[model samples]
Target: MIVQTLPGRRAFIRENTRLQAPPHTPELSLHLADEVTPIWRLTEEALEEIGLPPPFWAFAWAGGQALARYVLDHPDIVAGRRVVDFATGSGIVAIAAMKAGARRVLATDIDVFCEAAVGLNAEANAVAVDFTDQNLLNAPPPQADVLLAGDICYERPMAEAVMAWLRRGREAGARVLIGDPGRTYFPKDGLEKLAEYQVPTTRELEDLAVKRTSVWTLP
Candidate 1:
């Protein structure tokens, strides 16, 4: 299905599909399609075996890399806590939060396709995540103990809004952490960097072999 909606002045166009988990890995290969290029495939079993779920929006460059690295490093952040995986694309961060022992996980995305993608990927990983497809601007603020966001700062206005929300979360006593790959808009002053990694990115975006990404906490 294709959806078109106007959130104020910005145009939002999304194509989405609802799918079930595959009985075997072969039936569940994640695809990455570049501009004017054929889809590249990576299987679910490959990701699961490596302790990851399908990289939902891998084509976005920084998001996927930050998510993968976050899971590998700070699974404890979500352990025994209520979590909100903001802008959850492939449900990777949500799944990782669940695996890390989050009591409950809410995966959010404004994109309609994310509704199904997150559900399928969560089921495939045997993780339970409540999916919210509502626009963040209109939705209630999440009441989770921990808030996780990855690669949401590429765009200026979105980044600014997200930063404001995160600041509010911090003020409300929720632990707010973000995984960002040095995007131009990431707030630099109040955040304490936790971990850094070299991430996979595309040629169209940047020229680094691995982009430098970090997990930062708002102080």
Candidate 2:
């Protein structure tokens, strides 16, 4: 079933976020939350205020920003490939894949409001990205040549689940690429480091203003 966006959700996102270029990847513009705290503090009465899940889509996270920069600079990674940006908060990487000349891009986030957020941001960047809220864990690998994920190792269970799923995608012959800010749970054993970037982020969101982010591919 097509999940229709709730009333005022899209407008609320537009009103709450600011259109700006992320610090690390200025080649593309995105609709992003100017600050994290305000959205973080939103309450249930904030329904018409916004029914978003934690507003992860509001901020241009360091990992996503770094991955986007990599894709923009290295278009060959995704060019002419069908790609999927998993847990695509703010759709930054997905937008970059499309901008980098991917044949098609599907940005999937479990958060319901992220579809609206991704669409709005894609429009701002003049790129096309398909957004979905399906939880793809335990499902068979998607029909994609490339799979991209950023900052997915924050929580232990999620890290385990998504990493297992990503491994399946790799087993199916898709190139699995991930961007991370050195989170503790990031799997250390089987990845090839591709690039690194000093991503500027808010202290309110991350512990530091400049995070050392890296892009890696599965072995």
Q: Considering every candidate listed, which one attains the maximal TM-score?
A: 2
lDDT of 2: 0.86
True lDDT of residue 18, candidate 2: 83
RMSD of 2: 2.8
Please report how far candidate 1 places residue 43 from its true position, in Å: 21
Error of 1 at 153 (Å): 1.1
- TM-score for each predicted model, relative to the true structure: 0.72, 0.93
lDDT per residue, candidate 1, 41-127, as tens digits?
222222223433333443444654465456546667778899888888766677777876789988888754466556656666677
TM-score of 1: 0.72
